[model samples]
Target: MPLEIVMSVSFARAGLILGLGLTVASGACAPLRSHQGYIIDADLVNSVQPGVDNRQSVAQVLGRPTIASQFGAEDWYYVARDSRNLNFQKPKPKEQITLKISFDPSGTVKSVTRTGVEQIAKVDTFGKTTPTLGKKRGFFEDLFGNIGTVGAAGAGGPGGGGGGGRDTP
Candidate 1:
């Protein structure tokens, strides 16, 4: 091969490798996704006093809550989670913020509470077997269930079989 051609080929291979490495590295570092809810500034959250701020005023300053209380409509919850998910891997939450705002019967802000990642709850499943509906049977029963249904499928009833084989005669 010509020296010039060999040098150009080497440079092309190096460039290709650099480009592929960059692509794979970029994919491995998935962009951080922020699941934001009720985007209100921290200063605004503090500005709305419990005793002084009313529902309308608080709504104007801070947006609506991400979710309301399950049992009642007075409690408002503002939550946000920052997570990174690469490919098919489960999303790992890097940061989480939850703001709970309570309202009195008069529709005025009563209190504001905030919680961070410390509140994350770890849930453990009971066992490896997923819940399925059916009665548990032995291995023999499972193996014989289909095998025992053979005579019932042909043109024969219980204890009534027609054998054309010469051995049966």
Candidate 2:
């Protein structure tokens, strides 16, 4: 082969190698983003009232709660939440709120109890959002884009071309 032709071939090979390396490296370091929210404390809700607290008066004071009793209208529940996140990644929950109030047969306040008003560090898996700009690329996009067409196309084998088939000589 001519010396110039050989040198050009070597440069092209180097470029292909560099491109493949970069593609793989980028895949390994994909930027991560997430968001999460939760209610940090239920006591803050005490700004209203509890325990034998006046039901009608409390409702007027705290406004309507987020939840109510499933079987009857005698019980009411108030809920609070906090959320945080970065971007593509899922959000994390920082706090939660659960208020339970029971009323007597005459619709008077009987008892009030609360639960799940504790700080937590649980991942908010449901906060996933699909990106709008581009279709989500997977491992293949980076792998194929970086590898040279010749090498990548033939990676499957002699007869496989771009697929994973046995390359029979």
lDDT of 2: 0.64
lDDT of each: 0.80, 0.64
| lDDT digits (tens) for residues 121-152 of candidate 1 | 87889798787788987899888877756555
TM-score of each: 0.66, 0.40
For model 1, state the Cα shift of residue 84 in Å: 3.1
Best by TM-score: 1
Runs in model 2 lying further than 4 Å from the true structure: 1-52, 117-169
Number of clashes found in candidate 2: 21
| lDDT accuracy of residue 125 in candidate 1 | 94
